[model samples]
Target: MKKLIYLLFFSFLTSCSSFSEYSKETKKGFDEEDRTMVSNEAANLKTITFGDFKFATSQKEFRKLNKQKPQFKEILFYAKTTDVPYEYYVLHNPKEVIKNESFTYKDTIIGNSRFVIAVSKNAPRQDSEFIKKMVLSLR
Candidate 1:
């Protein structure tokens, strides 16, 4: 009984820490300015696709596609609630696949629509700029 209780506590602590890390990284994926600029861009889209991956697709389908793609490394996958509910994925390419050290991919589902955003490590400002451009292009 003691061993089972200890195992449960340990698991709880680790999961909490993992969520903290995910929340931190998700915040890093974008910023207030980007949010401000792209405020309504996503509102009108029925489908969002980036490369071969489409956002808001079934999680099972996504995993299958990711498995077929050799270059991408899936970092994390989780669901969270902000103003609305969404599923978020963090992914990266192997060093050989992308020469840049700071590159990262953030795929998410906002409501029923899927969206993908790319960010450079430690570059939240650039994240805002990139989203600004993406918003413009989407419109």
Candidate 2:
């Protein structure tokens, strides 16, 4: 919780981002692996009801990854809110998330953990901005 807060706050310090080249990195997949169908999970996890931001549920179509160490990894959760033209992966690590604006949205923040969001090259700014807030505010 503390780490997530820090990351959200940390994103505001940068004046400009250099990771624009890798902006599309999240949209590509490994050729070595077979393509998996994208799905949504609206029934599995009990969602704490929010106002109008009833984002999509966690579906199997989404992929999740994390470290195996208990001390190294605290709590990790993966979800995406499709409120915009792209998908912003809301990854929550109880410990740390690697802070990299290059691999993330401008308004979005990263800590010492793995955070990935899927968005099209022509996604809208409003959609991208809202997704970040939804992820960070999710409790």
What tens-digit string does per-residue lDDT give for candidate 2 at 5-59? Answer: 8887787643322122222222212122342212213111111212222222222
Instruction: Give the best candidate by TM-score.
Output: 2
Candidate 2: where are CA atoms >4 Å away?
Answer: 1-59, 63-85, 94-103, 106-121, 136-139
Worst 10 residues of 2 by lDDT: 42-51
Per-residue error (Å), model 1, residue 69: 18
TM-score of each: 0.24, 0.28
Q: Write the per-residue lDDT of candidate 1 for residues 92-120, one digit (tens) a residue.
A: 22122243444455455545444444444
Which is the leading candidate under lDDT? Answer: 1
Candidate 1 yields a Cα-based lDDT of 0.33
**lDDT per model vs. reference:** 0.33, 0.31
